[model samples]
Target chain A: MATKRIVVDPVTRIEGHLRVEAVVENGIITDAFSSGTMVRGLEIILKGRDPRDAWAFTQRACGVCTTVHALASVRTVEDAVGISVPKNAELIRNIMEAALYVQDHVVHFYHLHALDWVDVVSALSADPKETSRIAQSISHWPKSSVGYFKDVATRLKTFVESGQLGIFANGYWGHKAMKLPPEINLLAVAHYLEALEWQKEIVKIHAIFGGKNPHPNYLVGGVPCSINLNEVNAINSERLNHVSKLITDAMQFVNQVYIPDLMAIAPYYKDWGAIGGGMENFLCYGDFPTHGYNQTDSFKFPRGIILGQNLNEVVEVDARDPQQIKEYIKHSWYKYGAGDEAGLHPWEGETEFNFTGPKPPFDQLDVQNKYSWIKTPRWKDKAMEVGPLSRMLVAYAAGVTEVQDIVNDTLARLNVPVGALFSTLGRTAARGLETKLIVGWLKGFFDDLVTNVKAGDTTTFTKEKWEPSSWPQSCEGVGMTEAPRGALAHFIKINSGKIENYQLVVPTTWNASPRDPSGQKSAYETALIGTPIADKDMPLEILRTIHSFDPCLACSVHLYDPDGKHIHDIKVV
Target chain B: MLLLNPEGYMQNTKINTTLILGIGNTLLADEGVGVHVANYLNQKKLPDFVEVVDGGTGSFVLLGIMQNADRVILIDATIDGEKPGTIKRLTPKFSKDYPKTLTAHDIGLKDLLDAFYLLDTVPKVILYAISIAPLAEGLSLELSSEVESAIPEIVDQILKEIE
Candidate 1:
């Protein structure tokens, strides 16, 4: 077979444009590069705007995880302005975020990633009864099993009939990589529809609180909407119960349906475990810190820092420290001065239109023209891994008993020993498991809010009083939040009260990121190095791995309408 | 004024769902015009499943309702080469020749509705189009007077559609 590179530009259903380029040698992928083609300057565009607007604008950066961006943007501004949100506000935000988290994870698993593994065409061969049995074996819920599959068929039919392949258009149903019996495929297909409904329910929580999903209205001081007792009770009882059931159902599905499905499918594609698995250097800024303990302190959810390949002896991340962070744009197309000089806060950043052709694989020294609008973010002089896998690994290593036990059990079950549990599959599992933990955390948060409200905590939002003079001349702080993908950090600097500099080190920036100087590869890049590729064009393995990372380009930078194409110009051009 | 608020900001107002189409590019230019109008209708608490739409481009996307709707009021752009603020209400009869422009995104409203008719999705949807000025530039709409002026009539027609 003649060797050639295949570029799947603008991978569909993802938030933004991305090109997956790879070198093929005799039908094998010798090298691959994931490039983000869109350059969004939202970070810079956000400067000097009423910081409150960040809530609205930042979330627009990524549609999939818009809620996370909104929450984080609020947090970033709150941290910058120093405002302590009310308990109700915190709980509301927590619930909304958790809802989005579950929704996004479910959507990722069934809709996005599952298509790679679950063969859709095979479902035609499935016995609807056996499929129901397969679904039942996973978990028994009150829903009519027969009706569920029937609804699945109807919805699929409606979708096809709608002339909108809105979700499942590009599925490689008959691909060689797809493995799973018809019965299991049908079960998963049914679950996929269920997940969609669940996603709508979860998003409603946002609509109730934030007014809408996908760019829900959040405020710097607090959320714009309030929850009365009736609303709260309704959510706590009926809605929350349903959500809880869904989570539990999902866990059962993971253990029974997905795990078995993975196992059943793994044998056919054993080669995937080896490919797209990058350096295990994970970095988690941590989440759900108690009242007094800073993020560094261990809590129900712990912060994570993995210095190197050895996942043990987790390090602590200090947001106040500037020495540990530097964003290397050398390997990227950004025009930065020589070695170690590329790192700068976002406001003082440079925005130049320079398109250098794609750099060859393993060429870490070149800076002239690089692919991808994504920047290479480094923590403590290293490209650290961020996401559920990173968070879980940190939690497990830091002795979070529940996570540790789950990790151990899952690893033992896989028979690959307790170690490599931090690989591709591990990452996906971590995201799902993290949702379970977050839900519990949020329920408790709601309970605390009720208590606080009963105790007369009327301060849902506090106005930050800042004497213009009192504002620091220049200050830098790393704002870290748990985006759906993983840990997101924004190291911002304000000079004379305007945003003098800003740098967003996104979770994907670490995980799906490319290689950097010193020849250190990104977590995703390294992960892909060892994988064997059968067909370069049909880079299913690479897509699966990248999807595992759940890359969102909008959250990182600013995207502007560069050329306003009036209709006349559009035609002429 | 069409006062399109796809974001649904006006809940106390009166809105009938006889005709609703959301038009806008959640991704591109002042295309969100239809979404704004639909959202506005929604906020005003229009009839359930009011014909609200993001409309995007491709006014023809509304073709399915042409015969079904006794009177269609389509809210869109007015490219009369007039001042930027000019908005106009055009009741192009049910005989087709409706304007064809969708937002820069995929599947124009015309093609979408045409497909619906071709596929028999909604063979009897009437068409109501409001024309403002700008159709390109970016996501945010540049509302013109004619666009704004047509809102009340559009709302009235929508109520008529529902009635």
Candidate 2:
């Protein structure tokens, strides 16, 4: 049989413009290429800008995870100037960060990644009473009554009969790849609507602390919000109480609805546990600092590297070490000062355009050459995978009791072996487990905030090194944190209080990056190499593995054009 | 409970302010036209009831802002196979009324509008689609000369809408 190339340009339901090309031989992908089709010069724009204002601009890298960039950017400047925020400020940031993680994970599972698994059309065939029964068997979510499922079924019927699927239009409904029963599909559909309402309420936490949900205002030294129990205008007792309540609500959803649904659905797709395991080397910069930023022991998520699925050894990760973390653009559409093939540390990173691939409307990418806008970031000169799976595995290997207990409990419940944690299903399950752990941490952080406020320590800002005049003439710092997606780092070079250079190696870049100098395929490419294509036309299988990583190519690459004039339409047909 | 206004100001009562949201990435050349237009509008002395926002690329976070507003004017880059700087005005009642391809962050805005529709909180939405060349590389903070020249006209159009 002749090898056919399947290309899915502008992968739907993702954060940015991405093109995936797979070579199928005997209905199996033999080779794959993941290309970030956009390029925005954020690093170049940050040059000569005030270091303090970097967060506001850098956070624009992506619309989905805006807070993560701002958080990483502030930490980068704080690390450079040796500024430690007040304990109260740390607590507030932790609460806000945890809120983002919970909200982002839930949104990803339902809105962004769910349709890849649950067939929306099949829900119309579901018996609402049976769905209600199934929902009750899992957990005690209140919206599981037969009447509720019946209403949801009617809504699904209306949406289908309307002849306008809206968001569900692009889904490969009734495809052979979809394995969920109609009753289970109806249950997922009901939860999907519930999640939408739940997310809106959860973001109130961000609004309470940061003053906004999407693009929250952040100062260089501390959060923009000042805690004041007496002042009605400030983050008073009323608002604090509201945040606490929101956290409880979010935790209930994650515990009762999200985790139970994942467990119930996992049994139907156990075969996924054997597929989409790419680049066994995992990386996480460990986030949620309980103490000062410099104190590594205080981080709930530890920074380390687990190589080759070897749970026995965990290596320490020093993000600032140039020799340890470097980016190569040999197969990317950029040139380096050292040359095209040379690897440069992010501190010394350069963004120069050099598009050598065939122009758009072209059939296939020249995968052997420069084909993507994403730079291959190598950790210790190896392509490592980063995300919830990486964070879970690293924490488990480091013997984090909380992570171990959850992982053990989840594996035991699923009746799957420990090795199953290396596959796509594990990646998806890891996100749910991580969310459960973070919800617990969020409750503790909220309690700590309340305790601090009651203790009369309401200070949220430290203006120690805020002014440029009080700074060293030259310095550099690396801000590393575990974003909801994976490990995120912001490298900054400051000269006379202004940013001389700025570079960010986001999570998706590490996972969805193109080939590096060593000619090793990226995590996305390697994961797709052996994926069995039930139907090349449907390509649901491809979307399943890709969506497992929750690819945010917009955050990975900068912009979406190689030429200055031509516009390529994303044709769904 | 106190609500955070668009300007980060604390208001005693909920303000049914008119939101002028510019959604796009400024670093992506012409794609940032909406943001540029919003910034331009912000500089001008506008009515107290109008709030100009540079929404950037974050879509979900803007839902609260949209819900708070009585009316909304969204400016973004759209590719309708027209001239690079051609400006098209649309009052999108449904998500389907918007262009199929809305720059790189189409899902954010399109999906957001759908959510608003489902919740029945959708305000009167007037979109200014600044048709530009398709997304390709060559990143710049400056909008294309053609698009830059149309800013005054676009601002005037928006001013008239609010007036």
Candidate 3:
């Protein structure tokens, strides 16, 4: 029996291009390799520029992760300059980030990850009435009428019958791996559409706060929008009310549609609870700080590290500690002035591209050599998984009452133990649970903002240390935040007011990075092992796990055009 | 995954608009042409109906903005191998009509359109895909002379369409 090697290049329905190769003997995967095929020389663009303007550049790295990068970037400069944002600004930033989590997680579940589970073709065979019944049964979300479901099914059917599947074209539909009943598929599809429309409304909070959506404005001292209830130019009462309404709507959508859908879908994929539990170590740079950015104890998510699957105790994480987080290019397409064998802390990190050796063929990856454009990052020389699961587990471990309550309730409902929280199912469930929790936090933050505003703290920006003339000659700081995907950090070094060095260790770099010097595979690769591949040609199972990480590789492959050709499968090429 | 709806902005303006969205990544050379054209038209004293927006990569955030308009005219770069600066106008009836697989980002344009359909507010979608060469340079705002030259012609074409 020979081991069959399979590869899914440019995994669809993700933020960026990712190539995964796996060796499957019999039906189960034995070994896996993850490669991020795109290289974003964002740091190169940031060099020799004003440290204050870094967020605007880094924010362009991903269309989906627009605000997270901008937030991280602005915080980096602020941390370097030692500026404390005003209370209003802090509250607004937290509200914006919380809003992003709610929106990002919902989109990931329905639009991105839903297709991996709910088969669109199977959805056509669904009974709309049954779908409506299930929808009504799951949660009291409005618009679950029979007519609504019928209309959705009819539209889906029309689109399918037109012989043009479009976005739904390449789905591994009707695959044995798709376990949901047709009615449930239809239900998921309806919400998918609703989520799309609903998702668009959540970013209005960004527009009102930061003045734009995709690339919002961020300042070193504080947020961009000034708080003024009377003035038209500033964030007045009208704009604030609009934000308040959006948060309320987000809370409703999360509670009614998202959580209910997760509960309804989990029973069908319980076996997934055992597989895709790759690493026991989890890391989270806790976010949504109330006191100050430096106050980890005040963070809603709680700053900590869980080592070796230990949930009872959480190890403290310090981003500035050179010994804590170090990046290695052992199997990545990068080089170091210090050494390749040893990892370099991001401040000492080099962005020199060294593709000097003989190149592997375009399609085939020589995993033995430098195979990925992503650098391998490890916490204390150990590969730790990040994202919703890590944050939830950390919060749960730290005994955040809401997180603990939700996790326990969910676990009890699903009848799964704590160990299940590490698997693919656990990872997927964690995203939904945290979204519910984050929406509450958003509302809380929104109320806090309004209350503070009422208390006459209308300040949103600060001119304190606004000029670099008051700065030390050289300083460095690691601005860490837990993005929707995972722990995100931007390391910055400022010398003479110019950006002496800038490096972004994004969430994907931790989860999607290739094996390190010690040959320890990162989250994606390790998770894929032992998973059963139902079909060689269609690797929907692989997508289920990888999409769980919400990979944002930052694309660079718009070199050609489809020319009206329908891309049907995960092209091995 | 979310909204940045300038509903308040729309209310403040209080004018029915034929939204013209120029979509692309401005950081990439030709990929940012749509935004460049949009920024160009935005400065011009166009008719009240013409509302130009820089729809960066055309994802869900722009959906709320797009939905606010009565009709939408999307201008973007298309690499259909026709020529470096060939301009092609399309009234995309289906997601299949959009040239996606090899273009800037996956066809979030088409998927976004399909989502619009489910909402039952499918805006009159008109796409002007300006053909450009495969992007080679990195971290550039300068469009190639070929693509750059087509901007005025494309702008004229859009203006004519609006009229």
Instruction: Tell me each candidate's RMSD, in Å, in order.
Output: 7.9, 3.1, 2.8
The deviation in Å at residue A337 for candidate 3 is 2.3
Best by DockQ: 3
lDDT of 1 by residue, A1-573 (tens): 665655554454455445565556665566667666445355556566555555565555554666776777767655765666766676667767666766667667776678777876677567777767756664544443766776565555555455444334456667676767877777677666555434434454554455443356788777676444345423333444443444454455444543444444444444444445556577777765455224347355577686655656888776556566666665565666443346643434554444465433333222233655667777777777778877888888888888887667655655555445556666666676676666666566656765775576645555553333455666554556787788876655555666655555667776655566666767666665555555544567666777778766644322221121111110000
Write down the TM-score of model 3's second chain: 0.87
Q: How much is the lDDT of residue A295 in candidate 1?
A: 35
Ranking by TM-score: 3, 2, 1
Docking class of 1: incorrect
lDDT of 2 by residue, B1-163 (tens): 1124422332213356788999888767788899999889989998888888878887776776677777889999976778888888998877777776565463577778877755546678988999877655555677888889989999999999999
| Candidate No. with top lDDT | 2
Q: How many steric overlaps are in each model, in order?
A: 86, 11, 7
DockQ values of all predictions? 0.10, 0.37, 0.43
In the range A83-114, model 3's lDDT, one tens digit per residue, is 99999889988988888888889988998889
- How do the residues A389-487 of candidate 2 rate in per-residue lDDT, one tens digit apiece? 999999999999999999999999989998999888999999999999999999999999899889889899999988999889999998888899999
What DockQ would candidate 3 receive versus the native complex?
0.43
Global CA lDDT computed for model 3: 0.82
Consecutive 10-residue window with the lowest summed lDDT within model 1 chain B: B1-10
lDDT of 2 at A191: 88
